[model samples]
Target: MIENRNEFLSKIAKQLGRPQPTSRPERNFSFSPQHQVLANATQEELVDALVEQCKNIHTKAITTTTADLVATLKQVVTDYKATSVITSTDQRFADFGVLPLITEHWPQQEVATHQWQERCGQDNITFAERADVGIMVSEMTLAESGTAVLFSDKDKGRSISFLPQNSIILIPKSTIVPRMTQAATTISAMIERGEQVASCVNFITGPSNSADIEMILVVGVHGPIKMAYIIIEDQ
Candidate 1:
């Protein structure tokens, strides 16, 4: 079957009057002027654009200083009235001092962190499905489309981001880029460096929505109904 497929491909190439290329073609892959302009935007501009785009898509985008992150998170939790929360076990949450605050503020509320064995033992999927909110630290954010990039791993499980009623993503301002291309480039670099890339790299734009029936929009039918972004300025 493999030999037959190769022969068929060769015949098609011959019909096209060209040899099948054995190496990657060299070409200019630089961004256009408009894209370059966005790529060269200042940090403040990128953040502003990201927030604006997010809001336009009905996604809440909040900005806070590193010092006020904990306070801001408390405010968000209170505003949403989130009782049960699920989150990734990323160390950055601890480093930022947000995890302790969450535990302290919602002492009685069930807080589930992705732990391989423990998660499976406790049926983490069930917990996540019933969670009021799911929190995660975004690997990167794109300003042009207001997209948050998250890679699923043992610590950062896919369900924690998609199963809850609401999602709260913590994005460091430094990780915000101008466009998807920039975000893709960063991920490519990580792969080139022999990093263990996860099986799923989700690029979430906003809350899940579908307008297939009667032209009426339905949100969160397939995923989280509400999406919120907390941008940390001094990270």
Candidate 2:
């Protein structure tokens, strides 16, 4: 019985002409589009144009000094009557000065952990929900688009970002990449260096939400109602 079955399968294979598979061709599947329009732009002109375009995205941006970032954050919390702020444990944020503010509310809390999700969600969801603003340090910035790139890692958990009602990102001007091509190049370099990119790499343009309901506009449906970016001078 086994021999007959094997013979039958061999005959079918011989009749079917089973061919060996070959490797796929290397094609350019990159995000960069080789268009003439982008090729003609100077770095300064590109950054300026990108910044202007981003401003019109309905998001707020402020040119900030390191000093201003701390002061503004303090002021916003005070104005909103917010005593607590949820932030990542990333070393960069140490200099941004978010710890003291957070400590005021959760006195014993020195670091933000994922476990806060449940408590934060149950407590009106506004504390850190659509009203809870999370301030984070970005991995890089696209100068041509004035966009911030966020990568999820141990220090900066993914939940801290999406869970908040508003997200305030702090990026330095010097880390800005000129174009999408340059951004992709940086990504490729990271991959080559054996560094595993975060599970989620969010490219935040502005606040979330869609106006497709009746063609009217609405914000903060799926994400934060507001997104504020602090572009600090590259020093």
Candidate 3:
């Protein structure tokens, strides 16, 4: 794709009866309405927006202090009545003091916990498919849409978010942005820095809800049946 990008654009330019531009044209407008929405929102306001938006997407979202993160997560686990669980190997699980849920708490409750294993191959998919709940950290949270931005890597399998019956995402308060505009800008900056972004970046908006069949809303058709967000005040 990279090698043929210029050629692809040249064909489009020819159809439009214009030469291919040497570079992107300058923006004529000085301000963008999208960039203005919630542009000056405080962290608390952003959290509020996320919670409100989550309601519309059929997701439950709650805010908690870092001190109460583990307890809050445990409550969510119970709310979902999770039996078998799978979690991504996110460092935040350790940093936020929630790793015990995967390491000890669930085990004490006689629940099976499976962490994504890159070397184990299909074992990850098999476990994720059977797991009652999938837990992972949201790299970026979009307040406007109550979306969790997840970047998949070797230690984090994408199946954990899709193949499970329920999804419980841990979000850091500081990671909340106004909307996708800010999220895209952050990713563009990473590209500018020559940083390698994950090839599969998922912008998941709550649970999977489809309205394709006669415009009837059907949940869990494409992903988890239920999705919840526990926002941690790590800022």
Candidate number with greatest TM-score: 3
lDDT for each residue of candidate 1 in 55-158, tens digit (9 for 90 to 100) = 77779999998889998987887787787788777888887888676556566545443332244745777878888888899989999999999988766778
Model 2 pairs whose backbones collide: 129-165, 130-165
Model 2: how far is 139 from its true place, Å?
0.9
* Candidate 1 lowest-lDDT run of ten: 110-119
**Which is the better candidate, 1 or 2, if ranked by lDDT?**
1
The lDDT leader among the candidates is 3
By TM-score, rank the candidates, best first.
3, 1, 2
lDDT by residue for model 3 (1-235), tens: 2798999999999999999999988888877899999999999999999999998999989889989988898888898898999999888899998888789989999889999978879999999999999998999999998999999999899999999999999999999999999999999999999999999999999899889889999999978999989998887
- TM-score for each model: 0.80, 0.67, 0.87
Overall lDDT per candidate, in order of appearance: 0.83, 0.64, 0.92
Q: Write the per-residue lDDT of candidate 2 for residues 1-235, one digit (tens) a residue.
A: 3568656766776788953334555887675364333566654555566567677666676666776766776655454444356676676655666455555533443323222333344443344453356767778876656677888765565655676776777777666666566677788899999989887888776777687989877877777677777777657
Off by over 4 Å in 2: 1-47, 79-81, 96-98, 101-131
lDDT of 1 at 147: 92
